[model samples]
Target chain A: MALLEIKNLHVGVEDEDIKILNGVDLTLDTGDLHAIMGPNGSGKSTLAAVLAGREEYEVLDGEILYDGEDLLELEPEERAEAGVFLAFQYPVELPGVSMTNFLKEAVNSVREARGQDELGSADFLQYMRERADMMGLNADLTKRSVNEGFSGGEKKRNEIFQLAMLEPKLAILDETDSGLDIDALKNVADGVNKLRSEDRGFLIITHYQRILDYIVPDHVHVMLDGKIVRTGDKDLALELEEHGYDWVREEAAAAA
Target chain B: MSTTALDTSVRPEDRFISAFEVNHGEALNGTNASISKQRTDAIERFAELGIPTNNLEAWKYTDISSVIDRPYTLPLAPERPSLDTDDIAPFLIDDLDAHRVVLINGRVDEVLSDIGDLPDGVVVSSLAQAGSTHPDVVEEHYGKYADFEDEALTALNTAFVQDGAFVYVPSGTVVEKPIFFLHLTATEQDLLLQPRHLFVAEDGAIARIVEAQHSLSDAQTFTNTVSESFVGEKANLEHYLIQDQGPSASQVHTRAAQQKDDSVYTTISATFTGEVVRNNVTIEADGSFCESNFYGLVVGKDDMHVDNHTFMGHVQPDCSSNELYKHVLNDESTGVFNGKVFVSRGSQRIDAYQQNDTLVLTKDAEIYTKPELEIYADDVVCSHGATTGQIDEESLFYLRSRGLSKRRARILMLQAFAQEVIDEIQLDSLEEHVAERVRTRFSSYFA
Candidate 1:
């Protein structure tokens, strides 16, 4: 069985019943890095949001199985506790709540849900300092409010720092490299590479091929109009980068 | 009893209009002629304006009918109660030298107060005594700063103005210690007391004053007070008003502070009592480069009602104003906040900001907040925002999921929300005291 499997997922917002994700099917096994590249409004981010259990979108139909468990049945925080993490494209800022406090709360929450002992304050601080340094984040950033007054690059690096701290089994990077510079992009990619394990998997969503050069994926899928039109090896990213998406659209129309 | 006749003609016995006229007529013969004239003019204005109803924009949410239903008993030849310094020792602040002025049943208890240490050129005395000795100073600025035309409570306080404190800081002088004014009301019968305060800080002078209102008995009483502060050029004044009366009491207080060139005025108000309470604070920047800071925190539980109205006017150029008011309502309590800032046409380079935020813990609790800014100056920056909502559910859940019980999570979030406002208080001891009281009140909710 696949480590993460989605069979005909259909989702949309509550107020407007217009579907954003119409029957999207994908599968990824452990230790695999898969990139889903698509144009704007092609439901790329919707898939990542649905996998992370964002309440704004309603799952009208379908099944999302994570390690033989129904992922759709869990709450967002519960899904987070179940080793599923989504690096938001736009991170929410919480004023008056320090970054260290937020990470400690998130980490201890997952640990408590899994019937594991919580880390002490000293140990948690030491762990956060190490992960923060690895992500090229200053220790002072952890003392300030979470994501408040942070530059775009610093915000992205902070996301990866949280990813390293939580150590989710299945991570979804939703346009994580959109606003990052070359150096910040390398730092984030290095943080993701450090977290790669045999029991872990990643679903990288992006609109550009520049990030692919830093963190190469094993498989690349082209998503068009809420469905994966084609799937190929890492060379497909290079092909799309060189030939653009119009050729894939014509081929997908012919195949359909 | 004719409806049309009653509406057309202004009668001297009308409940709303007559209350002021009667009190003013009696106060003309009092010891202070300047205060007396000011009261007379204020009463005439009160008759024209009448008591504000719900239709009035400023008094929309808070209705004063319950307290104004019957005539308040004005104390007559009230005996001075015997009280010692030991009686008020618990309320004193350590490490600061303070002059204590105690008022018992709205009358000054001169025998019990301590006026020992005094800086040169500084004068502190009873308002009645000061009226006789310093008539020129009294005539110059007494009651001239308060607007009795529109405010009925100010008119009422002027109409029945009895005994209160008077403090005068000379030019270029700084009072190293805070002056404490304790207003204690103890009555067997339902009474209405109007306590007046006139404070003047001359040019480049600095002083700190704290006023506390408390009651000895749980009797039903109505206390209407007006405190007017005048700050001279380049002077600094810090004023604190703390209202913690009994649960059976009701109070309406109007405080106004006038600022001159380059002067700074700061006011912090904390209200934690009264079955019904309403406070109106107004600050006018009448000189260039003046600054004002207004901060308030209110906690209401059960069926208590607390209303706050604040107005800051920037009439001169290069002035700044900042205001923040926070409320925590629980049970069936209700809170109202109306904050307004006005920048005149020629008042360029003025900066003003106001914010009112409230948190309702229960469905029955209600809060109405309206924050507005009226700016005519093109070069000025003014903004006002008001928000009323419950605590953030995600933050609460995040806390609860981390081994903290549901109750602990709620307490932590509520404390954190209130801590923002508490942190703005510059006095560390007072801030800690207020925080402790807030925590104690919050703990009762869980019980």
Candidate 2:
């Protein structure tokens, strides 16, 4: 059985028929790391947004199934509680909310849903400190407001830091390597890699092949013109990086 | 002061005039000759001023014309009303090791008060008792800092002032614990409570004062409270006022202070819930090297009106002042903030900063803010700013994305915005107590 299965997914901007995702079909199995590579505006990020249930995206047709249950029936928060995480391309900044407070609430919210007790301050602090250490973040960032005045790399790192603390079963990385330098990308990839397990699945979306060198995925899917034109092993990513996106575009156009 | 009698065409004004005439003789029984003269002068001035309306620039946002529309018998008597202290116990700071002064309907309640041992020369008593005991001190400071002639509410308080807490700290003495004033209103019918409080910190003295206002009944209440603080040379004073207007409450508060050379004063006013509430605070820096810090937060919903007016006068050179006022409005709640900083001539190197920030939770909620700065000194740095906005959509989405319900996310963000100001409270227990109150207040919004 698949961890996540998307059949005939057709999505577009709300209140308009301008489609972004046209009958896209995909599936992710347990213990599989899938990478979606595409050029700008290739509907890569739109897939991530639709999967996260953003209000601006209207899912006109299709069904999203997670672990054999209809995922589209859940709210964004419910999706999050059901172990779907989208590592935002650009993490939002909350001016007055401290990182520790946000992480505590997030962890407690998920924990309570799973019939687990809320973490006490002492235990929570220890839990957070251990996770934060994996991302090379200090307890200091936990004290500061969440990503407020943080550098570009620091913002991405904070997202991965949240990813580490949440430990979601199916994580979605939407351009998580967009603005990161080599060191920061390695930091984020290392943080995500540390959380990978046999029971977990990940969907890594990127426009560049730079991040694939670190957290190599088992399956690589090429998206072009609102559709996945090709699918193969990790070698397809290297092939696309070497050959560029012309062949994928030609193939998608010819098929259309 | 204008002595011309105001046309008592306004029904509430007429009632007030009749009440003043009826209570004049008995109310002046214990006051000294000087205070008696001040009282008579204040009442006469109030008769001329009547109730201030938005026509006056200072009262533009808040119109007290409707505040006195209903007939309310004034709580002018000195008798303590009966109340269940247990029911009102939640308003008190549980472990606060401070001197407690309780007032029931504008009259001091000595039975419920706890005035622990104090250092010599540090006297805490009722305003009337203080006047009787320290005539010169009372004569020198009472009704002086308060601009009763111009403010009808202050004048009204001065006219029929009976009993409020009074604290006097002699030179070089430091009161270890805060002097807490727990003012409770316990009238079921429509009533008005006017309390007059005075604090005098002598040269090099230090004092901490905390005031909380609560009500016992669900009846309509109008409270007009006036408090004046006189900080002598190099003295320090800290004051905090929290209004928990219980069940159809309306309140008007005037807090004024005078700071001498090198003296410092910090004051905070927070309005948690009320039907109609307004606070006016004025600080006069009379000598060089003085410092003043002012902070305020007002939160309300459902046809509630909360207004705050603050003025900082830099009458001395080399002084610094900072002020921050924030309002969070939800569900048809309206808020108003008017702040002014005046740096007079020859007050060089005066640094003043004023900021007003408002957050509107719903589309129906509204907020109006005015930050005014008048700098006549060439070497002064004076700045004022005002910001009005709704909660950031991105921030809300971020919180909601992490498994928090929309309601929980909103409450958390609102708490964060309010806690920033509460964090400025220097007192430890007081800070925690205020944070808890703030959290509970936000909780009631969802409730």
Candidate 3:
């Protein structure tokens, strides 16, 4: 069975006529790394948001199955507990919530859901420090309020740091390379690469192919107007990066 | 005792006046001529001012008619109820090392309190004892800062002032540990209590005082408390008021502080549980270079109502005063914050800042905030702002997406919102205790 399966999924904003996802169909098997490349407003981030169970977006039609279970039936936190993680495009600042505290709660909650013992404070802190170091996240950031007063690069890096802390079965990275410098981008990609495992699946959604250089995907899918228009190997990203998204739009239009 | 609904026949003010007349002799009996005169004047002032009405600007938001209209046992000197340490163990902050002073129904319970060894020339005693022990200090500072003539509740509290905690630190004396005043109301009958406290920190002296109010009964209790604090030249004083009484209790608390040259006065008032609570805090920077900071946090749940009225008078030049108050109201609870920063003429180079922030958790919850600044000085920096809103949806989703349950996410968001004010608490034990109290109190609603 696939790790994640979305068939003919249509999503719209709650209490509005605007539709964000017309029909998004994708499948991710265990150990599969899929990169979703799309132009602005192509609904790449919206798909990620829907997968994470953001309440503002409603799945108007179709289904999302995670491990053969109805994914739409789960709450956001429940989806997280079920080994799904979404690296937010814009990390919200939680003033007065220490980064370590947040990570501890997230880590222990997932562990509890998995029928595992809670991590001891000492061990957890040590592991957090190691992961933070790997992501080049300042030790001080772990002590301060979560993402409060953090730089753009720091916020993106912190997302990867959290993804490392809460190791999930299915990881979704939504534009994590948006505001990162080359070095920070490489650092984030390295962190992601380290977390890649045989039993885990990754869905990297990005507008650029910069991060793909560090962590190559098994397959690259071109998303246009909320649908996967084309599928190819890692070379597809380099071609799209060189030829720009205009050709893909033309191809999708011609096919339609 | 069971309290009947509000009775509008006899005016509430007249009932208080009659109660004072009946207890005047007993209440004022051991007082010196000067103290007795002050009591008499205060009661007369109370009669003139009467129970504050909605027409009064200060009392506009808080309508205490229901609280005052109900018949309560207005005992000037109520008999202390039997209570052991275990009775108050639940109210006590864990691992706190401090000189404890316990007041039950406005009277000090020496048995439940432990004011261990203190440095020489430091007076930490009941007001009745302090009256005879440090008569000069009491005479000098008492009723001087809290203007009973203007505030009717202050006048009412002064008229029937009973036993309360009094602390006086001599010149250059530093009280190593904090002095904790635990005011408990454990009464069999509906009670009305008036407790008065006076704290004086002389020149170069430093002291920290924490006053907490808790109740042990289910009966309706109304507490009218007045506290006057004096911070002398180069002295430092930190005062904290923690109001977490029973659900049936209501309070009208008045705290006034006078700061002298180069002195620092910081006060934090946090209210967690009460039916109706009104806190009036006033600070007078009487000398140059004085620093005054007053912060407050109110976590109102259910149908509770909390109003905080604060005033900072920059009477001297080169003084700085900062005010910050935050409220988190859930359910049908309502919160009000009216903060005023006044820079008097000739008070040049004054820096006054005031901010009030509120988080209305439920759609039914309400917050009314007004930050007023009256600056007459040309060379001063005065900034005042007030913001009231619901929790940020983005922040909430961010926490929930990280594996926190919706309830837990809401708890974290509210805690984060209230932490700015809680972080101002200097005492580690008290800060932890208050934070846990807020968390536990918030968790129920979220759950």
- Top-lDDT structure, candidate number: 3
**Pick by lDDT: 1 or 3, better one:** 3
Candidate 3 lDDT over B1-447, as tens digits, reads 112222346888888777677667775555544456687888899999888878988888889877877878766554768899999998888878999999898888989999999999999999888888778898899889999888888888877776688999999999989999999999888888788899999999999999999999999989889899999999999999999896899999999999999999999999989999999999999999999999999998889999999999999999998899999998999999999889988999998888999888889999988878888889999998888888888887888888998888888888888899999999999999999998888778765
Q: What CA root-mean-square deviation does each model show from the true structure?
A: 6.0, 3.4, 2.6
Q: Give the better candidate number (2 or 3) by DockQ.
A: 3
What is the lDDT, from 0 to 100, of the residue A28 in candidate 3?
A: 93
lDDT of each: 0.81, 0.86, 0.89
Q: Where does candidate 2 stray beyond 4 Å?
A: A239-247, A254-256, B1-10, B83-88, B378-380
**Between candidates 1 and 2, which one is better according to DockQ?**
2
Q: For residues A164-248, could you state the per-residue lDDT of candidate 1 as single tens digits? A: 8888889999999998888989988988888888989999999999999989899999999888989999899999999999999
| Model 3 C-alpha lDDT per residue in residues A1-256, reported as the tens digit of each score | 9999999999899999988788888999989999999999999999999999888898899999999999999989999999999999999988989888889999999999999999989989999988888777788989999999999988998998998889899999999999888888888888888889999999999999888999999999999888899999999999999999999889888988
Ranking by DockQ: 3, 2, 1
| Backbone Cα, N, C clashes tallied per candidate | 0, 0, 0
Kindly report which residue pairs in candidate 3 clash with one another.
none
Residue A45, model 1, lDDT: 97
Candidate 1, residues B1-447, lDDT tens digits: the string is 100111223332255344444444453356877877676666666777777778899988988765655444556445565566776665555544567788877667888777778799888877777888887777877887778877877876776676678889999999877887878876666676777888999999999887778877777777788888999999999888777886888988888989999999999887888888989899999999999999988888888889999999899999999898888899888999999898899999998988898989899999989887888999998878878888877665444323344575576667667777777766666677777777787777765
Lowest-scoring 10 consecutive residues by lDDT in candidate 2 chain B?
A: B1-10
Which parts of model 3 have CA positions greater than 4 angstroms off?
A: B1-9, B22-26
TM-score of chain A of 1: 0.97
